[model samples]
Target chain A: MRRVLVIEDDPKDMAITRNAVLRAGLFPDCVATGEEALSYLLRNDCAYILVEPCVKGLNLPLILSLANKRDRKAAIVVITKDSSLTSERKLREMGILYYMVKPADDMELSMVLQNGKAD
Target chain B: MEKPISILLVDDEADFRAIISDHLEEKGYQVFSVGSGQEAISAAQEQDFDVALLDVKMPGMDGVNLLQMLKEIDPSVEVIMLTGHATIETAVQSIKLGALDYLSKPVRLSELEVTIARALEVRHLRRQAFQLRERLRQKEAFPEIIGKSRKILAIQQQIEQVAQTDATVLIEGESGSGKELVAKAIHRRSKRGDGPFIVLNCGALQESLLENELFGHEKGAFTGASTEKRGLVEVADGGTLFVDEVAEMSLACQTRFLRILEAGDYRRLGSTKDLKVDLRIIAATNKKLAERAKQGQFREDLFYRLNVFRIVVPPLRERKEDIPILIGHFLANSEVGPKPPPPVSPEALESLMDYSWPGNVREVANVVERTLIVSQGLPIRPQHLNLTSREVPLVTCGEKDLLPLEQVERDHIQKVLAAVSGNKRRAARILGISLRNLYRKLEHYGLANSEPLKTAL
Candidate 1:
């Protein structure tokens, strides 16, 4: 079973994503802030990572550093409130595998996760 | 048909003055009797006395001199001159010196009350007229546009120039930058000022819905089409049609919109009747349309047609000089109360200027409103702003940085876990990894039995 991690500060948002993953028949871990996220990854062998746009203290730079390390193939998905091509392109350039705008229904999340497996 | 009025009596002849004052007071009138002209002046100055009766034959300052002085003290005080001996010249002089009326021999109480009542009516009318004039002056000082910044002035000038022409205008700026305000300004100053001005946000609706919204739908056009409806374009005929976020329109919608622009004609949904609309088009967008056009996400021809007259509204950060003016504009127009919060502190203003307002003018307005509501009457401080200061940390990774992914992940997770007091679930969430993955990794890193890991779970 491929493991998934959700990095988000909002508790309600975290629960929603967790339930959505569970509905998709997957168990995922959740954290409150960016600092804790980096530490979790250091001791984990995660198959996939989900990040929100407002993850404090953990930004694109830190994510890039983690990606550049040995297992650079791990897929990362970024969630943002804004749905713009420019933002998507920027995330792509930063080595994020996928980008999804929030208030994303369960179907959209499931689709992204399925796409991740294929990739 | 008349009511008795109150009068203040002033005279050195206490017997005569008291007798007449009692006569008037008995006629349902309130009379305040004073001994001398000096006493009368002091009494009138303290209270709002409607009328004053002065004896024309007083010892020191007779009626005429006292009348002139009393008129200066209280312009509204009606003075009735009471003279036991009357002469035409003295009566004329008393009347000229501002006495309301002169009486001969013993003063008639009825006549005195009538004169005082009329004077009070005149005073009331004068006050009402003065109040009306002041209100009109206030309205003219503050006209519609709120900001006093030079940027706003420049934008106003641009609107004046563009409004006169029939050219299509494209307004580009970040979200909440008051693009609609600029559009309204153009329509207000345009030749079609009397005609209607309609707005449609392209990104807000689906392609089919947007089409129906822009072009009227025929009865039975679709499932929910219960009645015939005129679209925004037909309603906006002989006026301006402002399309907000035009870049968000679908490619197909763009083709049809472009054709309508080129031909100045459109057809209703489920109908073949061609409708001609004499309307001006004004479009706004936050996205870079040119870049989107190059990427084939937006139509190039449509972009050109809309970009004939371009107005780029600078973001809030670019126009930091306008912040104070904008704040003042909001403050003056604020309907808070008779008294508002103390002026925004310089430190707070400087912090606001330094912030990179991704939300633009609308965001600033929201922040100002929030600050006013939260701070009550206190001065707005930096902490009240609710803005996050962004700071970027500099880090260098070398060739030796080719550390194992697992090791890197472990080091980062350990640091974060330590920072968060060994909370595994929180640590995993922050790393964007699942709890199961975190546990598996803990086992892989040979830290599965660690006390911190146990405590965290």
Candidate 2:
């Protein structure tokens, strides 16, 4: 019954992500854009935040700034369509633990479910 | 077939290798003899040797060099240096490089044998220490008993005090009040900390099975005993044996247990060979053992014997101050997952603190897990706990509800069957009785004929 935040642009990708979250026994709160995701964070607390880096107008800095607040902080995981090493390094530097390329498997999702505990 | 204690004799001279391996083999050893250091290293890779005899003067690699490489290959193997040129400096260097001892090449056979025996003994102790260290490095499967309340502090003091002696300890507490945890603390602090800690739930097994589990059986001792078996008593030699629900121990099993307590000797179920084991007994029960003894339900003498050091663990409701700390611990340790943040809302915390924990710490833990799973990453509200089940659930009927022995047995079997959804195997395991006994019970109750065997989840 734990809640997870899913930020995805495509409906199909969002559906897959929501199903995986539900299968992990968590409620997924999906938003298509970073703006909506940030507003959702303003009202609700999540255990994990799943973000797609390639989403349109996905403001990483603003998302990070909002999530950096102590009470609202959640473990951020990057599921990106881009497999650039530079992007992965940037995500790692920003303290995202797992960076899954496009088509992330269930095992990867299960690992995120098991290991995600924001400090 | 598994080979016996093995020795590797490495030397430049083939004659020395042949002589040593033959002599060792004659003395009941599995010997692997090689000419040079390289061969020795490769041979070592294939199998482990208990002891190694190295000649200091080798053609390609010297004995000291081989000793270092061998140490890397299998750190457990003990090495002894054999040299015709015995310089004090070289001997010291060999010892420094991890040789067990250095001996001159003109060593006597008896002296060589004695050195090998000493090496084996040292190797055995080291191996035991290695295994103990590995086990110590891992956390115990059960959670540590956590509390800083006065009652828990007194219990901790009692554990420390009683741990100094090997006296029988009787821990009295409500179910899930952490009797087993207290027992573990005692054993860990006792002189027998390094030895095994064996636990048995007396309530989970029948009289005959309980006796067999504790005392073991010799092959052909009973119809299906098959091979000789070592029981918990033997396994707990020089350790601690914790008997939970000791009040549930049947009179017949109690009599057998009494003999072991008094004489410190027991025969395997089917054999007459007297076996002796040194162990500390720690018995625990949720029932009033003295009252049971007064009612003739438990043996008076056994009760007195186990009451040498009595420690009562208070129920969780009595020590409400510990509830918050316990909740935090359970949240952090939900599973093999990451430590979850303790995000219980104030109202939820107040509700938890106010509730009467009839099932004590165990019930609180279950609630913590269930609520955490439901709440996910959000702050847990009061409603998330779903605490409608207010009363302590009974595993068996209360004393007032006791039926005839036959009816009680039938009812218990029926309950177990229903729990497993008619799966006989799992029910047998839960009942601590064999499948044969279950079938017999079923027939006696006339249920086997009425209800056919069905596979169930």
Candidate 3:
């Protein structure tokens, strides 16, 4: 079982991701802030980190830096509502393996997780 | 016959007039009585009184003269000759002069009140009915934005959710994909609907002009600034400011705009005082802002700031199901005469679906409008469509003897496989054939040494 960490501020979005992960038969531990997520990764083991791009006080750059420090070999997936080619290229260069647009269907999310696990 | 029911009492008898006023006031009616004929004329000038009672025995202006003057003031003012005499011819002459009724000595208030009430009710109902008809007429005259496609419905849902809040929204889509329409919808649905909805196109002007356009300038801020002016931001105070093509805004302007977003205040171009405005910012862009930020063209901090909430409008090609509906809508409203040519043929629609719409919704609208103009009263045929062939055309290899279907298929498969490089798993996937089938086909075609096949694991 792979441990997945989801950092999101919106309760509704967090719930949707949590339910979708469960529906995909995967366990996802959720946090509302980036600080909480970093602490969780430091104390426990996580195979993947899913971060919302515009969370309060936990933007993409900050989250990427924290993930780099953990050295847990966890794959990072940046979720954003604005899925431009620029964001994709930047995230790819930052060592984040995948990027998904918000409101992504269950099938797309499942594919990303499965692909990340394989990688 | 019923004692000329309504009467306007005018007298110089202080005690007698008070008694008449009291009696008239008791009954449910309107009474405009004055102490003198001069007062009577002034009161009648103000509004049309149903009846007027004048004293025939006054000093300067007698009842006869007052009655004539009142008639001159308003022909509609009913005059009731009031006198202390029983002269028959005087009464007959008064009646001849258009006096409604004659009252002898004291007048009864109950009779006058009932008659006036009945007359006023008729007038009130007529006005009420007229207003109701006018309101109904207005409602039917205007057409509303219509459609219930999932894409449109989703946009409507987002409008409803974000409209009530003051959060900044970033609308992303290809040009002509209804970005402005969505912005308008948000403004209309928001609490700021009654407030001004100001739109500033960031692409239309240079950075200096745009800065001055957004933040007002004092007199002589620059060579062109001969007079003081309030910018769109200040003008849209207490409402919404929609920045269209926001990605085109210069970095200098973006920096200032970011501060306004954070502090909710900004200083005029040449003014020292910072003007605080309460407004909702709704910015739109066709460019990928995130990608621009990555390229160092757009500020990363500003991108994150404006991207508090994002509504991505799907391009027209993604939602082909809506094309026909949009066509019908645009056609119905088209200036083209009644009875537009026949509906678009199935073949034309199929061709349209195959052609990628690079310009998105705006392009689709332009094509529809152009088709209507060119094919007036004729069925819209594929030939009439101005579709550009952008897709790769399949090559024809023969004059009479065409290349074999298997050979063409094999060649196409080999091309795609080489492009992705010969990972059998990926190559087989791209060809939409089983790996075993692909391998067998390669052997049967005697092309097993194809570069893609060599790298096959």
Candidate 4:
């Protein structure tokens, strides 16, 4: 199975994301902070990186740059509770393939991850 | 037609239900008022409701229980709880139980309208999301089949079943019923999906041109043959060749094509050597090829060879349930002018639904395009359609408007000829008359100097 890295600070959201990723036929490696995510990326290569923009100790730009540099084939996905258009624009500018809001049904989230498109 | 928003109002108070129903009906919403929960469930089972207002304090099957049941029946229907007494616990519980909103009894009319509007908006967004997901899932395979009716679903299943094999497929349907789309879907799902898909319309050319196009001539084979050209059959090697209007093939071309179908090889017009090719054949016809074969018009052997598998696409009139969905799809995707086309009124939709679409799906698309131009960003009404009669009537009963039968016939002939850009063959076909007969009529009518009019029925 393909591997996906999920960075989420909240326990409830982490569990939901982990289950959704598993349901999409991918292995999920969960981390609570950007630092851990960066370390994990340095040590391993994954097909996708699903991250929450407000994760603890988050440095979105640095982490995205490093993630792209290390795993050139990995696709970045942003899942957050914030539905603000500005945040979506910034994440889009950072070049993410998927952006999903919170409370998205598991089926929809899994579909997005498998299809690699937010819509 | 834009469907009216339907609401299900369940309250024991007859006066309240009547007043609310009147208000909603005034706003052009279809309201189904029920005095008890059982009636509401029965109503829900009968037809789809966009929103439901349930009274929390009902005699039996209270609001919360009814909410769960309704959600079970159709999860997409938005529900709101209405109670005389409001409590924090009940409100939170109602929200948790999937009620979109909770309203206290004797609610202000303005507030109720606002809440109902919000619920409708949410329902719309949810529906859009569901449709998007469905399209995305099938985007790689056959996204062209847009209808969800039973007939369309059956056709989709047939496409999936036939696409797994390399057997020859014969698709039969009315004109403009999307036979080519089904053929392409089969090719896309086949093992040779990476290979090219070539299409040739047999009715669009003469016998000689069709044969030459299918099987090219060698260099110096003919007076105008300057270079050796590869035929469509050769180009479609390792792929699929879709032959549209195959019933129109002449006897000579049919004989040559039968040779290829039987032997898997064919010789060019001027070449003695037989060229072998590995290609799947998919043929489509709007006419009954079997009847043609029985009448000695179409080759029987070729018909049987191409009929290894058959998919019959029903006409638009047979599946009227899909009309609304097709209209939505066309309106959303058409690039005639601005970002969005004007909304279609209910009366116009009813008119469209009642009319018999003689030209099938293509006619629907043509009507939509024409209305987009005519409406000019305003709400589309029945007058904007201008359907059935594409031109002014030439034989009205009024004395000044009435014309002689010969005059009317002559004018109509000229109009049809102009519509088809003076293509006499097509004009004859559209006029349902023979080419020779049409020529004699044109000569007798003296229609040599008539100007072309860009209109067609």
Kindly list the per-residue Cα lDDT of model 3 for residues B1-457, writing each as its tens digit.
3332345678888888777767766663355567887787777777766667677777667788788888888766656677787488888878788776676765555554544455445545755797899986674331233355788778778878998888899999998788888887788778987876777777754566577668867766655444565666776787888898899999999988988899988988888888898889999999999999999899999999899989999888777777777767777766553574468888777777777788776666667767777777687878877875645345666677677799898777777677777677787898888999988988987767767532343
User: After superposing candidate 4, which stretches have Cα over 4 Å from the reference?
Assistant: A1-119, B1-141, B389-457
Least well predicted 10-residue stretch by lDDT in candidate 4 chain B: B389-398
- Give a tens-digit lDDT track for model 2, residues B1-457: 7669889999989887888888889999988888999999999999888999999998999998999999999888999999999999999998888889988978788999999999999998998998898786564422366888888878878888998898999999999999988998899888998877777777654566567667867766766444555566776678888898999999878887877788778877888778888989999999999999999999999999899999999999899999998988888877622355648899898888878888888888778767877777678898888875534433786788767999888777877777777889999999999999889989889878564434344
Separate DockQ for every predicted complex? 0.01, 0.01, 0.01, 0.02
Q: With candidate 1 superimposed using the best TM-score fit, by how many Å does residue A14's alpha carbon deviate from the native?
A: 37
True contacts kept of each: 0.00, 0.00, 0.00, 0.00
Model 3 misses residue B405 by how many Å? 8.6
* Residues A1-119 of candidate 3: C-alpha lDDT, one tens digit per residue: 87788888888878877776676566899998867876786687666788887777676676665565442556686666765544544454455544556664444455556543422
Query: What TM-score is obtained by chain A of candidate 4?
Result: 0.90
TM-score of the B chain in each candidate versus the native B chain: 0.55, 0.57, 0.57, 0.56
Best by lDDT: 4
Each model's TM-score, in the order given? Answer: 0.46, 0.47, 0.46, 0.45
Residue-wise C-alpha lDDT for candidate 4, range B227-339, written one tens digit per residue? 55456687677888889889988999999998878878887878998999899999999999999999999999999999999999999889988888888778887867457
TM-score of 2: 0.47
Better of 1 and 3 by DockQ: 1
